[model samples]
Target: MIAPARIRIFVDFWNFSLSLRREDDAFMLDWKPVAGVMVAEASQLLGAPVIYEAMHVYGSYDPAKPADGKFRNWFTTWLDKLPGVHTVMLERQKKRNHITCPQCHGEVKDCPHCHADLRGTEEKGIDTRMATDLVSLAWSNAYDVAIIVSSDRDFVPVADFLQSKGIKVIHAAFPPAGSQLSQRCWGNFNVINLMDKFRR
Candidate 1:
């Protein structure tokens, strides 16, 4: 008998999470059921039985902020308890840059409402970390199929490389605004259609 295909899932936390949010700003996802649905769908796509090997979520948090750090701890704890699920957290790097008015291209030093310094903060390293994990897993022969839940085009190359090695890459994205990653993958599955089965 042929062995079942091993399937692994990689989620870009912020990217996936934000996409799931409805217009009303409610964001909730029941991942256990979602995982089951993904595995079943992948099995059908592969035309073979498949085993759920693992699910990984990559994100970043700022440790210096008490509220953010506390929330990360709580969220990570909840995620770690889920079966076959792992959470990888990276430190959010801080950079100070002046915000300029788009119209005049002049530095905007103060917040219009609160009169505070309008330094913008950006989250870095999350995408690079996720890409590294995806490629590393493929090189290690971790799974026969990888289901990626991210809209970022940064992962397009990874998908191409994995497919070149004969591993199937599937993109699980929402409808209407599918990503470049989806076009590069072996198959594209819309999560929006499955929202009723797995969403909270």
Candidate 2:
């Protein structure tokens, strides 16, 4: 008998979460069964059974933000407990956002309305980390298929590189948003249409 295809899932946590929130802000998700759902869909697409290897989730939290602390706690305490799920949480880098005055081209140091500092945190290294893992794991022959659960177009090149190496990379896509990413992958499924399956 032929061996089942080994499947690994890579998720951009913020991208996936924000997209879901945009679709329905009130919906809660049970993330444990998400890997199963993706595997089932990939199996159907491939016309073969699949063995779920793991799900790697990448995200960042701002150290100075209170709200981010809560998110970080939930991510580590809850999501990290799920079977076959691995979470990589990075600290967001503080950045001073430069706002140019349209008339004089001067940098605005504070918000005009509330006089708040124009300093914010920017997410760095998460995408690059995810991309590196995708390629490195493929190089190691970790899995036969990879499912990327994000709408970010930055992964398009990674998708191309994997396909060239004869690895099947599937995109868990949100329509009209990740259309370019979908086009680059070996196969894609609309995550929005399957949202009900992941509801908590």
Tens digit per residue, CA lDDT, model 1, 1-200: 99999999998887777887852266567777878898888888888999999998888787777887886985689886799988888877656668877999998788889997666456788778877888888889888999998888888888888899999999998765556777789998887777777767
Clash pairs for candidate 1: none
> Best candidate per lDDT, number?
2
User: Per-residue lDDT for 82-119 in model 2, tens only?
Assistant: 99998999999867567778999998888889998787
State TM-scores per candidate.
0.89, 0.93
- Cα-based lDDT for every prediction: 0.82, 0.92
- Worst lDDT 10-window in candidate 1: 22-31
